[model samples]
Target: MAQAGFEDLVETFEFLDDWEERYRHVIELGKALPDMPEALKVPATKVEGCASQVWLHMTIEKGTLTFIGDSDAIIVRGLIAVLITLYSGLAIEEIGKVDVAGELARLGLNEHLSSQRSNGLRAMVARVVQTAAAAA
Candidate 1:
C-alpha cells in the first residue's frame, strides 16, 4: 500500500472535475486515517508552523515505520490524514526514498491549493520525512 496506493489516489483525484468535490473526496479519504491514540499526542511531538495544533510521532518496529498524529483543527487533521496515507506502512528507509514534491504533483495537489496551503503541506511532508530519517 505504498506506490500503487499512491497512484490510485492520483487517479481518484483526476476523476473529479470540481474542486469542492475533490475536497470532499479528500476529506472522505481522511476519515479512513487510522485512529491516533490519545497517548501519543504530546508537546514534543507537536508540529509547529501549522495553523492548528498538530502532533506527530513515529515508532519503528521490526524495521517498519508507523505514524501517530492528530490535530486540533478539522481541516488540518484531514490534511495530516493525507500525509499518513502516503507515508505510513512503509519502512523508515523507504519513507526517505520518496520524492514528495513529485508525488504531490502526481496527486494533483500541487496545482490545486492556495499558496499557504501548499506551504503547510510541504511543512507536514518535511516533518514526516524528518521522522523517517531519524528512525533510519
Candidate 2:
C-alpha cells in the first residue's frame, strides 16, 4: 500500500494540468527537504550510478525502516524526496513487498523522467532494498 504522503503527492500530481506544473511542484518539494548535515554526506552514504551526487542514510528500529537522502541536482533531490516518502516508515520486510515501479508509475514518473534520471532512481531503489533486506 502507498504511504499517506505518497498518496497526497499522487493527488497533487493529478490536480496539476501538465508536466511543466508537475515538474515545478517537484522542484518545490525538493526545496522543502531539510539540508543534510555535511558530516552525514560521507562516502559510505553516497549513492553511485547517479548523474548527480546523491546520498542516502537508512536506519531500522523496532522492525521499521526510515531514510534520509539528498542530491546535488534540484530535480534529483525531489526524486530522492519521493523515494523517501515511498519507502520510509515501512517495515523492513515490507520493503520487499512494495512495488516500487508500479507505485512510481502512479505519478506518471516512469513516463516523464529522462533515461539517466530513471536509471539513477532505479539505482537508489536498489540501494534501499538491499539495505532493508540486510536489516531484515
Candidate 3:
C-alpha cells in the first residue's frame, strides 16, 4: 500500500466534492497506515485524554524526530496518520515551532471533526510537541 503524504491528502481532499468522500479517504488513509507492534503500545507511550486508546512513540536520531502512532478508533488512527505526516522526520527546532492546530485547520479537518475527536487530536499533538520541546 502506498502511503499518502500531507500534500497528497490536501489535494485529495480538494478533489473530493463533499465531506463524505473526504471521510472515506481518511478511513482509507488509516487502512494504509503501517501496523504498530503490540509491544510498543504500552502505557508509557499512550496518549491521554483521547476517547480511544491511542499510543504515540517518538524517536530521535541525529536531531530529527520520528513519530509513530496507533489508535483504536479508525478515524482517530487516520488523524494520527495526518499528525505523523506533519511532524515526523522534522528537525527539533521545526517541531518545536510547528503550528499543528493551524495545519489541521488548513486541511479543513478541524471544522469537520467532532469535539471528542478534536480533543483527542489535540492530545496527540501535545504529546509530540512536548517530546520535541524536551529534545530541543
Residue 87 in model 2: lDDT = 87
**What stretches of model 2 exceed 4 Å from their correct place?**
none
* Tens digit of per-residue lDDT, candidate 2, span 73-127: 9999899889889989998989989999999998888999999999999999999
TM-score of 2: 0.97
User: What's the residue-level lDDT of 102 in candidate 2?
Assistant: 94
Ordered by TM-score, highest first, the candidates read 2, 3, 1
TM-score of each: 0.84, 0.97, 0.93
User: What tens-digit string does per-residue lDDT give for candidate 3 at 1-136?
Assistant: 1123666777778899988888887888788889889999999999999999999999999988897889888988888888888878888778867766676776789899999998998898889889988988
**Native-structure RMSD, model 3:** 3.3
**Residue 90, model 3: Cα distance from true site in angstroms:** 0.7
Candidate 1 is scored at a TM of 0.84
> How far off is residue 108 in model 1, in Å?
1.8
List candidate 3 stretches off by more than 4 Å. 1-4
Candidate 1 lDDT over residue span 40-105, tens digit each: 777778787776677888777887776767776665676777777678788888987888878777
Tell me the lDDT of model 3 at 17: 91
The runs of at least 3 residues in candidate 1 whose Cα sits more than 4 Å from the true structure, single-residue gaps closed, are none
Ranking by lDDT: 2, 3, 1
